[model samples]
Each structure stands twice: as C-alpha cells, then as structure tokens.
Target: MEAGYLFLVGPFAYTKLGKRANADTMDRITIFCFVASYTLALMLELLHSWRGLIAARIGALLSGLAGLVAHTLFLYSKQPPLIWQFSWLLFVAWVLVVAYLTGAIHYRRLTWGIFVLPLVLALVGLAVLFGQPPERGLWTTYETHTLWGPVHATLLLLASVGVCVGFLASIMYLFQAHRLRTKATPGTGLRMLSLEKLEEMNRRAIWAAFPLLSAGMIAGVVLLSRSEVVSWTDPRVLSTVVLWLLFAVVLFLRIASFLRARQVAMLTIVAFLLLLCSLVLSHNQPTGG
Candidate 1:
C-alpha cells in the first residue's frame, strides 16, 4: 500500500514541479530581452546601409524575426489579458515590428528597418515609463472583456497603427524630397520609395485610419456610457476626439486635392504628434477597458 501511494504521489509531484518550472522560466523573460534584440537589428541595418554587406542585411532580418518571436512569447506569458496600457503598448510595438519586417523583406533594397525600428524602441521605452500597473492592479475582465470593449480597443489600436505608418511615410517623403532638392545621393546602400509612392502611401494610411478612428470613437462613447469609472469629459476622451476630427479634416483636404503632397505630409506628422500626446497623457488613467 505504501509503494502504490508513493508512486501516485511521485507522479503528481513531478508534474506540478514541471509546470512551476515552466512558469518560472517564462516569468524570467523581461521586455529588455526583445528591446535588445530590436536594437541590435536596427544597428545591423545601419551597418548594412553603410557597408552594403549582404551578411549584415541578413543578420538584421534574423534579429528582427527573433525579436518578434520573443515578443509574441512574452505577450503570451502574461497572466492578465492584453487590455491594459502596458500590454497594449507592447502589442502596438509588435505590430510595428511586423510592419518593418514585411517591408524589409518585400523591399529588400529599401532601408525600412532604420525608420521603423526607432519608433518600436520608442514605444517600448514609453511603455516602461508610463505603462506600469496601477496599485489596484490592471482592470479585470469584468470590465475589459465586454463585447464592446475589445471592439473599441481593437479599432483604436488599428487606427493608431495606421497613424504610425502615415507618419513614417510622411517622414520618408520629406527626407527623399530634401535629398532630391539638394541633388544628393542616398546613403551607400539605402534606397527609398519614390516621392509619388510615399505620398500615395501616406494618403492611403489616412484614408484607412479615418474610418477606423470614427468607428473606434463611436464604440468608445458607448463603452464609456456604460462604465462608472471614466467619463466622456475625461482628457483622454477629449484628446482622442480631437485626433479624429483632425484626421477627418486631413482626409477631406487630401481627397479634395486642396493640399499638396508636402502639405499633406506635414499635416500627417502633426496628427502623429497629437496621437503621441494622447497616448502619453492618458495611458496612466483607468480607461483600459
């Protein structure tokens, strides 16, 4: 009887220990792991541009891929859902990394990583500063897991991504335009999309973002009306509404052909700045759901 009892207990103990070890290993993963990875990738991209080395290019791509894997794993390891500011910022960074990788692979001659990776690092840095859990802990599923909550958050997230893309495109357009105006050559191995292409990209991003922002704001208002915590008059809410209105005006001007490419790019950059303000000022609030 003693041997039989020992055998059953031993297996259970072993299994429990194994599970705990896995959890402990996962817990050891900090944001720095991926931050370092992305930083290395960005440095490698810079090196590739200067030296024109295929190895450096491949290394940068591999580093980005590794970072992406680590980022996904880190996100999966989190106990709470991805509804809060901390997780949301990380998610946004993840999406930007995905965009960078796609562009790097598809437009291998273009230095997409150099432009996009810095923003990824910045987002992660911001996450570190402003995205810590509150004293009461993150908002629980009771508030964040409702039907409208995810919809609202997701729309906003996508819209934010669009804004980021447009910002990058605008910057690239300005850089390329300046180079052309100066009759300067691109960096040794660096290539850029044409001015026209960059302009088109910026326009498309705004077009996509406007509808998403509109839908997100609508969903947000509905979600807020039901919540007792955050009010419509909250700074976060007001700022986001302002952002949407700015996007609307920009989109209309672009469609109406009233604004030149450079003018539109400037407006897009302004929109991105407003978005940064909204994100920085409001991330610490209890508006996660």
Candidate 2:
C-alpha cells in the first residue's frame, strides 16, 4: 500500500512536464515501464504463493528498478522545466504503479492497469496532440505575464489527478462488488479487492480530493478576478465550476452516507467519472480568455 501510494504521488508531481517533453517517446516509455513492472510483480507473487517471500521480494525489487529507470528517463527528457505540473504528473504515475504492483502481489487484487493504462495513454496522447504551441493573444499573454497563473493551473491539474484516482477507485469498487454479488471467483488476469477495502479507498479518496479540488477552483477564480484579459465567463472558468459542483455533490453525499459504505463508494465513483468528463470537456474547449 505504501509503495502504491508513493508511486501515484510521484507521477502527479511531474504532470507539468507532460507537455514539455516528447509525448510519444514518454508515452511509450511509461507504458513499457508499467507493463514490465506489472508482469514481474505478477510473476513474483505467483512464486511467493508457492516458493515464499524471498522470491517475491526479489521480483518486486527488480520490477521497482525497471519502473524507476523508465520514470527517470521520462523525467530527464523534459528539456525546459515545466511549471509544477510536471512533478505532479510524475507523482501520479508513481502512485498508480505502486497501487498496481501492491494489489497484484500482496492481495492478488484485480489488475487495475487494464482500466488505468488506457487512460494514461489518452492523457499522454492529448498532451502530444493538443499540447502544442500555446494560443496567441490574451490567454497566452495572461499565462506568461501572470506569475500566479501557472501556479493556479498546476493546483487545478493536481486536483484533477486526485479526482482521477477517485475515479479509478470507484471503478474498482464496482467491479469487486459485482464479482462478490455474482459469486464469481476473480480471474487470473485480474484480482478483485475486498469490498470493504474498495469502499474505504473510495471514501478516503473523495474526502482527500475534495479539498484540493476546492483550493484549485478558488485559485482559478482569484486568477480570473485579477487578470486583465480573462473573465469569469471564460470556458475554463465555467467548466471548472461545473467540475467543482460535481465534486461538491460527491462530498455532500459522502458525508450524508457516512454509515452506508456501499452507497458512498458507488456515489464517489460516479462523481469521479463526472469530474473526468468535465476535465476532458474543458481541455477540448477553446479559450479566448
């Protein structure tokens, strides 16, 4: 669990670099690293299930190094430093890797990579495709001149990453629940987390993410108010509000169903998905400032 959490943190810490580096190269490296590590971890876990801890630890270490190397290469390739988004992205990736490894090895949990990898690829692809040259004029001017602008954006991006975690947790919880209710054994390709753990994770992720997300939204509003070129009606602003509201509802329901763990977990999952949709929409929307 500690490893998984750390892995996720490392990637988000480096998200800003996503747009600064060679996206295709970085994407390939990341995908390769994750798949390699995941495979090794699975093999080790299988050995441990038969041969015991020594074999498992060795496998984990080797896989960890492979993951680290891939991560280091990806980070080093970013020429000019990006705003803190780069660090955050790295932190996020690290955490995901850790989660996948730990879940697979220790708990024999479902292979979350099946769901998560494609999302990572999509994000990287977006960075490669639309992340090119900043638009000229007011928005660009605001971004470059306002020192606080990048900071604000970085905070929002991190918040979005947190929401992504919540989304992942929710999906996992649903799958696990469905498996339990159906009396089906988990497949070899995937390991299902216990319903209790999944629900707990979903709850915790939502609670933690809500505040960070709220801070990001507040920073954005402040930026809009202070900026000369930007307005509250900007698509970014409106979309942020929409995302904020979705998270707010998730939080509200979370508090309301503090006792109903299952319900809270399902709602958290829904809210996170909605949050993701809002982010995609915002990313695609053009900004005129």
Candidate 3:
C-alpha cells in the first residue's frame, strides 16, 4: 500500500512540475522571438517575389503563422494584461499579422504580403521602443473596468486597424498606378491588384474608419465627463481630433471628386503618417480617479 501511494504521488508531482515548466517557458518568450519570425517571413516573401518559388511562398506562410502563434502566447503570458501603449501596439501588430496571413492565403496571386509585412515589422519595432510596463503600472483595474472605457478602447482599436488597411491600400494604389504609367512589368511574379480595386479598398476602409472613430471619440468624451482624472486639454484628445479631421477631409475629397485618385492616395498616406505619430506620442494616463 505504501509503495502504491508513493507511485501515484510521484506521477502527480511530475505532471504538475511539467505544466509549471511549460508555463514558465511561455512567460519567458521575448518580443524578439516573434519579431525575428516575422522578419523571416518577410524575407521569404521578398525571395518569392524575386525568384517566384512555390517553396518560398510556402515558407513565408509557415513563418508568419508561427510568429502569430508565438505572439498570441506571449500576449497570453502577460500578467493581468492591461491596455496601454506597448501592449496596444503589440495587439495592433498581431491583428495586422492575422490580416496578412488571411490575405496571403486567400489571394495567393497578389503581392500584398510584401507591402503588409514591412508595416507589421515597423509596428513591432515601434512597440519595442515603448518597452516594458512599470512596476507601479499606468492604469488601474478600476479604470479599465469602467462602463465606457472598454467600448472606447475597442472602437479606437478597430479604427486604428481600419486606418492601417486604408494606408496599405493607398500604397498599393500608388504603386500600381506608377507601374501602369511607366509601363513597367509586374516585377517577376509580383502581381498587384488593379488601380480600381485598390482605390475601392482605400475608400471603403476610410468609410468604415470614420464612423468607428467618431463613435470612439464620443465614447471617450463620455468617459471624460464621468472621470475626474481626465481632462479636455489633453494632447491625446487634441491629436485624435486632428486625426479625425484629416479623415473627414479625405472622405470629402474622395466623395466630391475634387482630388484625383493619386492625390487622394497621397493624402491617405499623410493621414497614415499622423496616425503613426499619434500612436507613438500617445500616453497611457489613468482613465479615472
């Protein structure tokens, strides 16, 4: 009886220890892990573009998928993960990676992966610049739990994703347009969507972004009115307003036919630049007292 009990307990202890070890390994995963994976994927994409190898395309897809899995696990490992600049940027990058993977798989003929992967790498690099969270932490549990807080954050995140989509589409439009104007060959197997489709993508992304951004701003205002910790004169608020105005201007120009597609693409790129600035300069202040 004693021997049997010892055997049972030994197995249980070993299993528990194994789980703990796995958890620790996951927690130990650094941003560089996924960054390197994504970089590898991007390089594979470039290789495919240059050589038109099916093997390179397959390798790129696998690498991207691996990076995404690592990114998800790393995010899950965060202790009581809170929404803030560093984590938010990571989340955005993760979303874009998912989008890239989906598009790459679905539209195998298009060279969107080349354009999108660079942006993903840039976002990850920017997130690294924000570094780790402080011991004291920037946001309290109570702040994030507030009624309007999550709503506002979710909308803004979606809006950011939309802006990124528009930015990419505009870039594709410009490239396709330039290629057409110069009558350049589509660079080996590097096929792109026509200018019309690219323009439509840009327009639809902005159309979706405008309303989401507006709703997010409204929710933010409501949160501000309810919270003593937030103020109207915050730079973040002002920058957000400026960002919205730029979007509005772009929409008006696109709708009014005042600016051609090429000009609209240029303005969309400008908005994208501002969006990057806003993301970089954004502070993770406490949402409520």
TM-score of each: 0.86, 0.66, 0.85
* Reference-based TM-score, model 3: 0.85
Name model 2 segments beyond 4 Å from true. 1-68, 79-95, 102-110, 132-139, 186-189, 258-270, 282-289
Ranking by TM-score: 1, 3, 2
lDDT tens digits, residues 1-289, model 2? 2232223234344444345456677656644565466556556655554454565656655665576567666655432122223343444555565555555456543454455544544444444443533332322444434544555555665666667677777787777777777778655335656777777777677777778777777666776677776577766566667667777876776667654666666666666555545444545332212
Q: lDDT of model 3 at residue 243?
A: 85
Clashes of 1: 0
Task: Measure candidate 3: CA RMSD.
Answer: 8.9
The predicted structure with the larger lDDT, 1 or 2, is: 1
Candidate 3 lDDT trough over 10 residues, lowest sum: 2-11
Clash count of each predicted structure: 0, 37, 0
Q: In lDDT terms, which candidate is top?
A: 1
Query: Which has the greatest TM-score?
Result: 1
Superposing all C-alpha atoms, what RMSD in Å does each candidate have to the true structure? 8.4, 7.9, 8.9
Order by lDDT, highest first: 1, 3, 2
- Tens digits of lDDT, candidate 1, 132-219: 5553334453345466666676678788889999999999999888888888866543678989999999989998889999998888
